[model samples]
Target: MRLVVFDVDGTLVDSQHHIIRAMTAGFAAAGLEPPPRAEILGIVGLSLPVAVAQLLPMADLATQARVVEAYRVSYMQARGERAAPLYPGALDCLDRLSARDDLLLAVATGKSRRGLDAVIAAHGLQGRFVSLQTADGHPSKPHPSMLWQALADAGCEARAALMVGDTSFDIQMARAAGMPGYGVTWGYHPAEALDAAGAALIAEDFHHLTRAIEDWAS
Candidate 1:
């Protein structure tokens, strides 16, 4: 079976607005100024602690932990206000991929398991993925552990798997796990950055993403 792994935040859904808002609130809660939106977006795929640390390089451990919690709280509040929507064509792509018997879908995301489950449920995406890996269970992106575990769970070789994501960290993780990475253009990172991070293919839209995956599997 061919296993296809996806990143959640930027790759599947457009949560940047929530992310930035929550991040700004979190920093304010900690009595600090928020990082620029571009800086925050750049760290979208890393686990919360790592992302916070990157955003506040000079922060003490206590401050970083506080920011993390504050960010979570702010994010939860934002979710209550409005659900983030899936990217255009994301659902259609998932439906098409799910129809293929020879393919297994999985998720490798920086989100906690609970967060992932919430998104899946919100979108009625039940049973769409065979394996799910989250930051709560593994190290952050670019580490390869999540992808490796996903391949193991799917009983698929790395060579038979493709990683789809929007960040350089995701591309690096796929490379480390011996899989070709497919970058999505509409995500957090730029196409040039993805190209430099070694994306084997880049998809500008959901149609292109679906075709690229099908072609790779074929």
Candidate 2:
């Protein structure tokens, strides 16, 4: 079987608005100024804890914890009203991949279980994925645990798997796990960064993404 692992936030869905809004609220709760919009966007694919730490390196542990909690609550509230929607063409791409018996879809995201579940249910994507590796169960991105788990869960070897994501972390993880990395242009990271991070292929658009995966499967 061929394994295709996807990243959650920017790769599948456009959640930057919710991410920034919640992070801004997190800073507010901690009595600190919100990070610049550019900085916040730059760290899109990172796990919450790592993102928080990188954004607020000077913050004490207590303050960081509060920020995390505040962001979680804010995200939950915002998500309840209207969640960050999947990108245009995402459903079609997923559908095409899902219909292929040779391909086994899986999710390797930095989102915690609660957050991942919310997005999955909201998008009616629960049945689309065969496995999900959440932040709670493994080390965050740039680590191979999630990808390794995905391979194990899908009962596929690393050489038969492909990692699709929007950031360097995803590319690095794929490299560490001996799998090919496919980068998406619509996601957070720039094409240059993905190339530098050792991405084997970069999809210029959704159609290209689908085509690339199909070609790989064949």
Candidate 3:
């Protein structure tokens, strides 16, 4: 089977606002100031633990733990009330891709299982992804565990898979997995940065994304 793995936060969902807001609350909970938005945004694709570490390098272990806890609580509450918006055409792209018999869809995201579950259920995207590789199970992006797991779950070889995402971490992970990576321009990372990271191609919109996949699979 041909497999496609997508990143959730920046690619499929525009979740930066919620993430940043919770992070700010987390800092307050830990009695530390939140990092600047640019600094926080730069580490967008890292898992929660990693992101927290990067954002608060001087924070002690106890403080870090407290911050993470607060972040989880804040994020969960906010997510229920207001989950991120799906990128334009993201749902449609999923729909088109999942319709093919030869294709197997899955997620490789830095989101927690709980977070991904919220999105899937909210968007009526259940069962559209055969497998989910969340931060809870393995090392986050820039690591190949998520992609590798998705390949195994989808019953496809790495070479037959494509990683679709919007960050350098996604491209790096795809590289490590020996899979082609397609970067989406509308996500967190700039197109130039994605290109520098060795993305196989960059898609400007969902139609372009679909065409690339169709061409690849054809």
What TM-score, over all chains together, does every model reach?
0.99, 0.98, 0.96
Compose the digit string of candidate 1's lDDT tens values, residues 55-154.
9898899999889999999898888788889999999999999999999999999999988988998899999998999999899999999999999999
Which should have the higher TM-score, number 1 or number 2?
1
lDDT by residue for model 3 (86-136), tens: 999998999999999989899998888988899988888888989999999
lDDT of 2 by residue, 150-192 (tens): 8988999999999999999999999999999999889888999
Candidate 1 has a TM-score of: 0.99
Q: Which residue pairs collide, candidate 2?
A: none
Error of 1 at 61 (Å): 0.4
Ranking by lDDT: 1, 2, 3
| Winning model by lDDT | 1
> Number of clashing residue pairs in every model?
0, 0, 0
1 or 3, greater by TM-score: 1
| lDDT scores of the candidates, listed in order | 0.94, 0.91, 0.89
